[model samples]
Target: MTHDLLVIGGGINGCAIAREAALLGLSVLLVERDDLASHTSSASTKLIHGGLRYLEQYEFRLVREALGERERMLAIAPHLVHPLTFVLPHDHAVRPWWLVRAGLWLYDALGFDSSLPRSRSLRRDDTGYQTPLRQAYRGFVYSDAWVDDARLTVLNAVDAADHGAEILTRTGFELAEQAGDHWRVTLSDGRTLEARAIVVAAGGWTTQAMTAMGVPPRGKLRLVRGSHIVVPELFEGDHAYILQQPDRRIVFAIPYPGGTMLGTTDVAVEDPSDARISPEETQYLCDAANRYFRRQVSPAEVVSDWSGIRALYDDGAGSAAEVTRDYVLELHDKGAPVLGVFGGKITTARALAEDALGRLAPVLGFDAHPVSRARVLPGAMIADIETLARQVAERWPFLDPHDIDRMARAYGSRLIELLDGVDSVRDLGRALPGGMTEREARFLHETEFARAADDVLDRRTKLGLGMSEEERRAFADWWATAFPAG
Candidate 1:
């Protein structure tokens, strides 16, 4: 089949672009080498906000656009994206008090249209952030958002499929050669596709994908690994903290279910695939948290951890921490047109899709009208999520309230379909730890493209965190038996 557009990569940007183009009346095909959001997209700090720290970098335009998209996400996917308050503790040794206040002020002003509350002055004892060793100081409080980054990517892919786009996972785009006005593309599965225009939105492997298509690298990326450690819950509040390191780098300690998600060190690396946590990075994060909180953390205390490559655009900032988070889309028109993407934030992925299609529309002879923001993603049609959760709890009284709440966030308005005909626990089929059922696994496999166990446990939901080694093994055994190889 000759698709109008063939999108490479299945990260946030690629899925967003596929959804937008499919909505624009184009015959589209999106191919991902592995499960969607299995890599960098799933490993995010899971915040949906304008990079408040970017204000110091003077990236006003990028921050403004990200804030706009943050509001858009709240409108389109309210169930998946919710407000999160962050308290920034002032440190006289790290940065000037006036500078921190001024930066927070700019961060608030730049997100002018944000429905979230503006930044305000805060006291040392004002919130969950505290320490016995630290001296007296002040801070600021503001609101951003938290998101299921992996689900957001998958939801976009689901919406694209609804709009008639062919999505193939475990399908790699190996090579492409010119075939008159179109490109003859080869896949890892021995399939050939004809595409009028190609869009490369591969996250970390973007440069290499460009090389395969016989195009010179148009953008340089500074690969920075961001690592996070999950430790036992440190504070009681729902709020998070933004800690300032002496080296001018900022780390975030957000609230997780069973633990506080502490993170994110900016260290440079040569390859994007080398996304593994180091002992030093773990200690670095623990120290970053211990510096603020009375409860000290050790590497041995880390229950779980993750590392993802940033693959940021090289703006000649010398250090990887200073590199720009803004994305660059380069187009080449030698025979068939090709568009390449690099370094985009999760909040602004929908906007990035619009920019990508705008470049491809003129070349491919199609009218690209904008409709993604209006056409809301799947599982997000409802206006209120709390009411929906209440309804689900009432309908399925057999289910636990906690399970209902988690499913409400993960599946949104689609919970009815997911749990249809299940009036009791027996109907839910074989049960696993963390409230996972065989029926739920089947639904994920059939609808959400969750083929493997981790695809359901990790990306589909964070249920894996609560499962033990024996519990995980039991689920794996059932999964292998239930869905044998074709």
Candidate 2:
């Protein structure tokens, strides 16, 4: 069967584009080489902000667009994307107080329609609740949003599937050739598909994908590696810290579920697969955090670390940090129409998808209307997540409050659907470590395209961090026995 669109890549942008196209009445097929969001999409700093530091580079356009998208995402996915206050302590040596205040003012002005509170100045006493600073200094608190990045990608894929798009995970696009008016594509699994148009949103692999498809590279691609480290909690509050480094770069210390998430270093890499956080990068992050907070961190304190490669459109920038985070869509009409996606951030993926479809509309002969602007993602139908969690706790009085909270945050309104017809803890099936049950695991495998234990414990949820070594071994044994390798 011929599809109207064939999307190659299961990252947030590709999934979002597929959902948007499917909702626009197009028959779509999306194929992912590995699990959805297993790469760069999962390895993010996990913030939905306007890139406040970008204002320094005169990237006002990107910041404004991202700020608007941030508002829209918060409105639709309140459960996963909620407001997070950022405390930027003024370091006179790094940036002057007046300059910081001006930037905050501009940020607030740009996000005029934002639901979050505007930025505010804080005295030393006012900042006492956060990690103790080495010295007394003024600070500013501004608003942004946090997200379960992997879950966001999965939700988009789920929504696309619900809207009649065929999603194929663990399937690789091997080749493509023009056949009449459509492109005949071959998959690694020996399956074939025909589509009038193809969208390549392969993240770091964009250049490789285009090269493999015999399409000439439209622009020079630079692979910049961004790394993050997770450490034990450093503060008491939910508010995050944005620390300015001597190099004029910024590192964020966010309040993660199990600890403080600190990151990220921008280093130019040669290969996309070489995205491992180096020892020097880890030390740099620790030193950056130690320079601000009185609670010093060492490489030994790192519980876990991850790195993602950004395939950016090289604009002759001097440093990787100076490269543009904005996305570029290149349309090639040589064979069947194909669109190659360049650089983009998670916060602007929805907007990027909208722009991509608008550009492809003329080539594909379809009128693309804005459909996802007011639509809510799957599992985000609940308006107030706290109220829904309370209701779930009330319904299941025997369940642990912590378990209920985790489930509600991970599944949102879909928590009910996950636990449908189940009563009591035993009904949930063998309780794995971190409150996950066999029932929930099976649901993720059957519905959410979770293939392995890591897919469940690491990406889909961070329950792995809370699991004991023995508990993880037991879960692995059970998973292998239940769903062995194909």
Candidate 3:
């Protein structure tokens, strides 16, 4: 059947756009080549934050808009996104205290609801409670939110489905041709769809998607690969850290999936499909993690690592970090109208969706009514996280408090639904090593359109990060039984 809008890409931006449009009563079809959120969307630093580091680049407007979106996400999807505090330790080698204070102050002042505590200076003696490395530094605590980036994308897709959008994962748009002023799109799976307008929200493939439609690429998407390493828990609390290595580039050591998540080296790549972190990048990340933490991280200690490429808008910047994180849309009237997306971050995806629809309003001949601002994505909208935690505790009485805490933080009110009619942790089904469970796998597969083992264990969940080879293989074997490739 022909749809009003066909959105290519199941990343956050695509899912969000589809969700927003479908909720506005548009007939939308979202197609993804792989499992939903398996690309750059899931491979994020996992922060739903206004990038404080972007301040150095004078991206105040982007930072402010992102900060506003963070608050809205925290409110709308209280389950998937919530407030996270970051302790910016003042190193003598880095920027001075006053300069740091000014940045932090601006970070706090950039127009966001103050549900979280305001920025504060902490003494060195008091800062040791936050981290083990407590030498030659003061601390400044500020707010940013953490998110289950993959789940956020999936939930948006789910909501879109609830609003009548057809979501097709493992089905890719292979080609597009004009048919009487409309577009006839061929899917890689041998399916064809007709749509009056199309939005190419394909994260890293924006250029290629547009080029296939016989349109010359206007703005280039600079593919920058970022990698993360997971290690054993290195002291905890919800507080995360931003570390500036000796090379002046910053790395984040975040609290993720019950372990310390260390990350993110920026290396430019010509091909997004070929992007992955190299051995040198791994060593660089470990060295950066070792610099701040008292416990040194060796390569052997890296349990697992994952990489994702960021689609940055090329503004002729020499360095990946210097490239703008903002997004741009190019509309091609050639054949059918193709609105191509380039370069966006997770924090601003919702706004990006609205902006994209606004841009397409004139072309589609249908004004997209405003939506998604006051709306809550699926599995969010919990009245209170504390009350939801209590419900989860009652439902899984035998589960470890720490594991339950992780579930509650990640799933919010949906923890009860996920654990529905199940008593004790065993009812949640087979436990792979590192807290991996069969029930969680089934949930992702049944609800979120997860078709592969890695989609379940790696991106949809972080169990792969902590799983041993034996454990990963076991999960893979079980997953193959459940979902063999077609």
The candidate that achieves the highest lDDT relative to the unseen native structure: 2
Q: Over the full model, what C-alpha lDDT does candidate 3 score relative to the true structure?
A: 0.82
Selected candidate, larger TM-score, 1 vs 3: 1
TM-score of each: 0.97, 0.98, 0.92
Residue-level lDDT of model 1, residues 1-486, one tens digit each, is 899999999999999999999899899999998899988899899999999888878899999999989999998998899999988888889888899889878888888888999998876666344443254448788889999999999999999998999899888999999888899999999999899999998887888888888886777888899998899877777888888988888989998866999978888999888899999999999998888876788999899998989878788998888899999998988789989998998999999999999989889988877888666678987758889889988888889898888888889888888988887889988876667888888888888777788888888888888888887888778888888751
RMSD of 1: 1.5
Q: Where does candidate 3 have its weakest 10-residue lDDT segment? A: 127-136
lDDT of 2 by residue, 1-486 (tens): 999999999999999999999999999999999989989999899999999999998999999999999999998887889889888888889889999999999999999998899999876667454436777768788999999999999999999999999999999999988887679999999999899999999988888888887786778788999999988877778888999999999999998866899988999999999989999999999998898777888999898899999888898899999999998999987668889999899999999999999999988899999999989988887868789888998888888888788888888998999988888888989877667889999999888988888889888987887788898888888888879962
In angstroms, the error of model 2 at 405 is: 0.4
* Tens-digit per-residue lDDT, 88-206, candidate 3: 77776877778889988898899546577888986656644444664556768788889889989988998999889999998988999888778998999898889988999888888
True lDDT of residue 203, candidate 3: 81
Q: lDDT ranking from best to worst?
A: 2, 1, 3
How many clashes in each candidate? 0, 0, 0
- lDDT minimum window of 10 residues, candidate 2: 123-132
- lDDT of each prediction vs. the true structure? 0.87, 0.89, 0.82
